[model samples]
Target: EEALRGLKMAMKADSPAKDTAAIVIEPVLGEGGFYAAPASFLKEIRKICDENGILMIADEVQSGFGRTGKMFAVEHSGVEPDIMTMAKSMADGMPISAIVGTDTVMDSSGPNSLGGTYTGSPTACAAALAVFDVFKEEDILGKSQRLGDKLRKRFDQWQEQFPHVDNVRNLGPMAAIELVTDKTSKEPRADFAAAVTKKAKENGLILLSCGMYGNTIRFLMPVTIEDNILEEGLAIVEQALKEIG
Candidate 1:
């Protein structure tokens, strides 16, 4: 409610409201920590967009293509967005991006109105097609869900065992843990996070840190990773935590 109120105030700050073109949001925050927005909040945003004649654009670059146990993170909210931008895993790192929009919005522009030098390279298109085929044949969504369950279980154990590991969270396999000076005060421990990532790298595991204070360690392992390989990677992370904690 507070967020929505703030959004409403921001919208009203501009005259006539239509001055605001669109509200773009990431259904699951990617680099800003792996926090999934509440479904209710998304629904409210949809409602506000409808009432205000503003388009709701969902940036699903990180949370799409089975990363979040669903094809798109916004599916969790059941709120249809006016436009969606996707990439990253779409072509399995083929460097292609796409924008999908409602028919009305898409048709608002004419042919050749939007064109870039490398708009649709045949190689990238083929790669994207192959990726879609793989998803169809491999039941990748199911694998993603199972991977998320495994990751959550491990994260829960870490939270219980480590004092600084606080606010363990995930949206499907898109998981993260926040390092804090202490759980009681929740002071961000950026140094601890950096140390853990550095240690994990030294141990042959590439880990990433994000969040406003750079105190969050995010996990973005491949959804198709073998169980044994996943376990091995996780062991490295745990070892890093122990050494740094």
Candidate 2:
């Protein structure tokens, strides 16, 4: 809250900071190591935005569409923003994105002031609609919760056994393990994470790295993956880690 107030102060008269427009953030950081913004932080942001006239934008590019076992990650914090941006999983693999906002905010712009050549491309729109159908029929949100539970359990165990696994964080099924050189230093070991990802791929389990130092193993597996397949992939990861050791 203090940090937020300080930021607001920076935008005051004669301040070096330019006049503020809006604050955009990912409810659950994606490439930033699957870090989920704390509920308190999100609520504080909303409060600050409301106190001022600043618009709050939730960028749900990777955390929307049941990825975090919710329709949108902001739902977890129960903080609704003035605007929400969604993409990536919205249309599955299709090229599409959406900007949803209150009618008043949306209508503030003149018709000629806001238009995209592919704003409503039929193919992308159709794909997004299909994704909604799948979500409804398959109960994607429920699946995400189940998958998250399963993965979290294993991650907890891994953290206990591997001293290198500095942190295990997740929002529903969007999970990640941060690597460190040692518990005391907690220094990110990017090389170790990169090697683990490469080794996992060699063992038939693909993994990705992220975070400031690229020392985090982030998981983006589909929530609908078969149980056996999920288990097998995890096994491969375990094997790869053991081999790397």
Candidate 3:
């Protein structure tokens, strides 16, 4: 929060960008790596934004639609945002995004002020509607939490067995294993991460790497993936790590 406050202050100092419209953030970062923002940090930012008349926007593009054991990642913090953005899993990759805000904030925008060519296309809307049905019929949120528990247990064991693995982070089933040269030094092993991802891909396990240093292997398994199939995919990852390193 202090770091964010410092940035806001610095931005306010600039005459041109002095307004500081909104502080947008990913509650649980996606491609940037799955570091779930601390609840306290989120709450503090909410307070800061409130004090400065700045909107707090939660970008839940990758962490929304039950991926993080909640409909939206910000819900975990219990801090309502003036504005919220969602995509990715919203329409199951139908290329649709949404920006919802409080009535007061939304009403402030003039008609035709917020829209795009594909904003409300029927195809994407149909997909998003179906997603809502599935969410109602299936226990996706609960399953996500259970999946996280299962993966975290194995990841913890892997950290103990693999010297290069450290900083295993997870929120629901959204998880990542940071590769480091040594636990004490925590020096990012980008090479190791790359090798593992390449090997996993070659072995038919579609894995991805993220983080600022590109040293973290992230998991984005489908919430609907069957338990047996999920284990099979994980076994491939375990094998890849064992063989690559």
Candidate 4:
């Protein structure tokens, strides 16, 4: 509710309402920590966009294609966006992106109206099609959900064991752990997060840190990772935490 109020206030403070065109949001914030927006907040945003005659664009580049145990993160909110942009896992690193929109909005432009220098490359399309085939054949969504459960369990254990490990969260396999000075104060411990990532890297695990205060260690492991490999990587993270915590 506070977030919605802030949005409304910002929109009102934008001066001319006619200048507003669309409200773009990431259903699950990627680079700004792995926080998933509440479903109610998303629904409210949809209503606001409809009432204000503004298009709602969902940026699903990081949270799309079964990353969140769903086809798209917005699907969890049951909110249909006016426009959606997807990439990253779409082609499994084939360097392709796509934009989808409602028929009314899409048809507003003439055929062949949208084109980029490398738009609609045949190779990239083939890679994307292959990816879809693999998704159906391998039950990727189910694997993602199971992976998320495993990650959440591990994070919970870490939170209980380590004093600095706080605010462990995830939207399916997109998980993160925030390092703080203490549980009561909740002061961000950017140094701890950096040290852990550096130690993890030295121990043969690639870990990334994100968030506004750079105290968040986000996990972006592949859904198809083998059980042994996943455990090995997680063990490395635990070792790093023990050494740095």
Q: Each model's number of backbone clashes?
A: 0, 0, 0, 0
- In candidate 4, stretches whose alpha carbon ends up further than 4 angstroms from where it belongs are none
Off-target runs (Cα >4 Å) in candidate 1 are: 14-16
Task: Encode model 1's per-residue lDDT on 108-159: one tens digit a residue.
Answer: 9898786654456898888999999999899999999999999999999999
TM-score of 3: 0.94
Higher-ranked by TM-score: 2 or 4: 4
Cα-based lDDT for every prediction = 0.92, 0.86, 0.87, 0.93
Over 62-171, each residue of candidate 2 has an lDDT whose tens digit, in order, gives 99999999989999999999999888899987888888999989989886876655576899999999999999999999999999999899999888877788689888
Cα RMSDs, all models? 1.2, 2.2, 1.8, 1.1
User: Which digits, one per residue and each the tens of the lDDT, describe model 3 over residues 62-133?
Assistant: 899998888998999999999998888999889799999999999999988998666868999899999988
lDDT tens per residue, model 4, 134-171: 99999999999999999999999999999999999999
**Residue 145 accuracy (lDDT) in model 3:** 85
What is the descending lDDT order? 4, 1, 3, 2
Write down the worst ten-residue block by lDDT for model 2.
Answer: 11-20
Q: Whose lDDT is greatest here?
A: 4
Stretches > 4 Å off in candidate 3: 8-18
Give the worst 10-residue stretch by lDDT in candidate 4.
10-19
State residue 57's C-alpha deviation in candidate 4, in Å: 0.2
